[model samples]
Target: MDLREYSVFDIMGPVMIGPSSSHTAGAARLAKIARQIAGDDVKEVQFILYDSFANTYKGHGTDKALVAGIIGIDPDDERLSHSFELAKEQNISFSFVKSDKDASHPNTVRMVIKNKSGDVIEVLGSSIGGGNVVLKEINGMSVEFTGEYETLITKHIDKPGIIAMVTKVLSEHMINIAFMRVYRQLKGDMAIMVIESDQTIPEDVRIRIEHIDGIEKAIVVDSINKA
Candidate 1:
């Protein structure tokens, strides 16, 4: 059936496993997607919930669902109820914060995840409804993605001509950039680049990016489609 045929209430009403579909199921899915983007072997996580999520998370099991997802629990698993104790047993550290931002979505969540290697990543996402979500930002870029693309997330020194240099390599190799976003922390000194593409980045291109003058690091996030 075409999703558009369903009314918002019709779509959201059948999802009755939680306190609120947007707050609970959507929150769980958002956390799961963030975990997928952050990769496995995560050692720690921090979840910040906004507005409605903040107010009802504990009662709705949104907190447990988020924690369960980071600990690698499947969303439909009955073990989600024990996720916190499981995390403690597994030695995975986690914390929660509530942010009441007037500008944020009611079901928005910001997750900071750290892998065992101490590499850190931050993802901002929102659960729209019917257990659906969109990753709105990563590392401060205004990006709209579903965590289903082969990706490269990089941080570099911001400078003129960097885009041409990177795109040149892809163009030379016949790779297509499906989506690209750049976030600048300072005018010309610090920036992050997140690129989702139609093909896997070759090892040679990865090495070449590391050698580029203004680039700091070019790390390929594993294919979300494959994961």
Candidate 2:
């Protein structure tokens, strides 16, 4: 098996404000990814923290960190100390529930967020140490993407040539796709496509994708949080 070498910074730590990178920093990033999926109109959020996060989140400021992220603050920001007050000021209601499920990652966090229009979405993520995170699930579909590239998530009905049509739009925009993956519930039912690209996907590309014949939802996210 090939081994991935750890950088010095990876071995040491990331510049962050937290008691534990896994509990606090990782949790913050997890919430940040969830916020991206839920969009800015979020009104209420429910966090389902599992294992270590559930047991010691309060003590380690993991709860505050998650709230800070939902408000668009990074883990390294000083405002993380006042995340609770900030959340209250925004009127974003939230609840934390703990559960231990077999076959689930210990550092997993599942978030259910609701918007003003009563639109609700669920996202699951895991913090993989050193402030890095992975987007695990979206709206009950199993998908995965690292927060390392300009990512696009699309939900559509499974059909032939849909992938080609989507990529063609991106190509027209001159966007280079670094990675692409498709996941489906069944052969001909719903499907989720994840694309991580070298450059940000333009708003027009997203709209065009949404306008496609079979596409249902098209979400464009920047790993740099530019969106």
**Highest-scoring model, TM-score:** 2
Which parts of model 2 are misplaced by more than 4 Å? Answer: 1-13, 224-227
Q: Estimate each model's TM-score.
A: 0.70, 0.91
Task: Give each prediction's root-mean-square deviation over alpha carbons.
Answer: 4.7, 2.2
16-73 per-residue lDDT for model 2 (tens digits): 8968887888788778777877766778999888888888888989899988888878
Lowest lDDT sum, 10 consecutive residues, model 2, at 218-227
Q: 110, model 2: CA deviation in Å?
A: 1.0
Kindly report which residue pairs in candidate 2 clash with one another. none
Q: Worst lDDT window (10 residues) for model 1? A: 9-18
